[model samples]
Target: MTDLNARHAIVTGGGSGIGLAIARSLAGAGADVTITGRTLSRLEEAAAGDPRLHPLAMDVTDESSVADGIAGAVAARGPMAICVANAGVAEGRNLLKTDLTFWRHIMATNLDGAFLTIRESLRSMAALDYGRVIAVSSIAGVRGLKGAPAYSASKHGVIGLIRALSEDFLGKPVTFNAICPAYVDTDIVTRNVNAIRDRAGVTDEEALQMMVSQNRHKRLIDASEVGAAALWLCDPASGSVNGQTIEIAGGQAA
Candidate 1:
């Protein structure tokens, strides 16, 4: 509902999935959007034909990359009033199968990446009196998933960070929040389906059904649904809604 004609927004992993939907949604709302990912080709494809979309190749896990990428974007466009830390990978391995390498990879991408993005975004955002920072966490952050200890931990860290930051900036013009969605129909779900099939020795249909069954509505959530939530969080009316996790689960799981 906010007119974002002059606002500049940054969405990581905007090449595909929920990130792409959020990018398009923000741009459609009149904001100039900068979409970043590791792949230049995909970012280009996502931005093509949309003047409001600017593509920047960024690897969020690297401090230098995030610093330079955001700097270039702010220089070319303007200060970032909205920052969405949406780049992440979802995978599950039981404690028995989980090693330091696997656990570190998840934490680096899901948790550390978000930290770097938010920190860098604040530099540009400080110039403005108001800003919004939203992290894309998961239902796992609310409750532990059956087999994804590391993924769940990473999401938990995200919500914890948002909560603490909100209080740290209380009474300021900036706000921090997170979204915890259940079973979104992103490419991540398809990959998770395949993993479930292989691990449980079940048919693809059965594997998919397992995920669907977890949703109270017994259906996969659309990516655009999450996008709409992101748009709402960045809206001017949402300034008072900081430190909250807006769960997109079909029912009250918490």
Candidate 2:
């Protein structure tokens, strides 16, 4: 296990699913992990009395909230050495039915949220000698997913943001990367299964299969699998693995 004692890390949307998995992995490695979400109760429940996992209420779509929330976390736990921008909303809508409100909502929570989280974390990370910025992107980011134009575009934007930041801080100690996973077994999938059932007029099991079939292995990925990948990226030996999109898609993504 990589020792991260005394290090401070922040994970947005850490109340559940992939974010919580990543937070647990970091905390297990001895890092002081702060988990943020819009719901305080959910965050606290997820923390489950773990002293290392601190729960914080933060609305990522709001810039002031993100800035102030991150500033307070830094103030309490020292500089942020690891930042995981994992907060996101996943919904699929046909282009003809997609309203501007829906599109902007996705962009706000996915693209803009990652931008704000990374920007605020960088304020302290840039001053330090070692830092890691990890954004949770999706397989849709690398390829277009039918019926989800807005979501796909927003995730693509996240990859672009991370890649550009990697270039901007080239030769610096801080490294930026995005984790792209395919159909992870999370609450997001369960909700989307219901949505798919309604949208496609299929049984719940059939709708779930629709997603399971998308992965090359024909199975839903475990959240812990993605968590392990993130921990690897934060390892001391991963300093050279910057500006990359790691696809945990069970096999060749293409």
Candidate 3:
């Protein structure tokens, strides 16, 4: 049996993309996973035909929703031993054109959402004395992304939060860490490409190439690559690997 056999995990934004991949990986490792998203239908569809994957409707931007939703999931499946705060928003806006609304929205989802998810998950994890808290940050977190100042700042905030929590819980059974990736092959990247094309009047190929070029390898990263990194963090030997940012940017030093 896998180390995660019979473990209970909570994955935010697990209905699709990198989040979904992580959920599936945990489930495959024998975890009973609860997947959350803003759209119940999408969550349901993603959970469809998989008994190990449970669907929960949640809007990470809403504190009340996160509290109630996570509480309900824990009540049903037991305390969450693994929490993946993978829900985030990525948008590229220059500082000159960015408004408060856009900045707040990004912060609320990427930074605040992670704070709430980790804070609430710790409640259950503390009781159990064993847990893993993993946040999906980005390459933007470690280095500045050329047109995405807000995104980079929010991601950097995520790593900061994780580092603080890790220090607070030093020597405890629970470990907190963040995974930073660059240009992963997800719908978010596709949307960003489209947005770039629209904003800069660039062709589709040009927009896509722009993102690929940002990566050290000059290619889109696979979602499974991140999933495997998450799996490693859950390993028994990884207990000491806390408060660190694991970067998957094709060898870019962060």
Model 1: lowest-lDDT 10 consecutive positions:
1-10
TM-scores of the candidates are 0.98, 0.99, 0.97
- Expressed as tens digits, the lDDT of each residue in 1-254 for candidate 1 is 66778999999999999999999999999999999999999999989999999999999999999999999999999899999999999999999999999999999999999999999999999889879999999999999798999999999999999999999989989899999999999888889889999999999899999999998899999999999999998888888999999999999874
| lDDT on C-alpha atoms for all candidate structures | 0.93, 0.95, 0.92
Residue by residue across 37-144, what tens digits does model 2's lDDT show? 999999999999789999999999999999999999999999999999999999988999999999999999999999999999999988889999999999999986
Q: Model 3, 38-146: lDDT tens per residue?
A: 9999999999988999999998999999999999999999998999999998888889999999999999999999999988888888887678999999988998788
Evaluation by lDDT, superior candidate among 2 and 3? 2
What does candidate 1 score in Cα RMSD to the true structure?
Answer: 0.8
Ranking by lDDT: 2, 1, 3
In the predicted model 2, the residue pairs found to clash are none
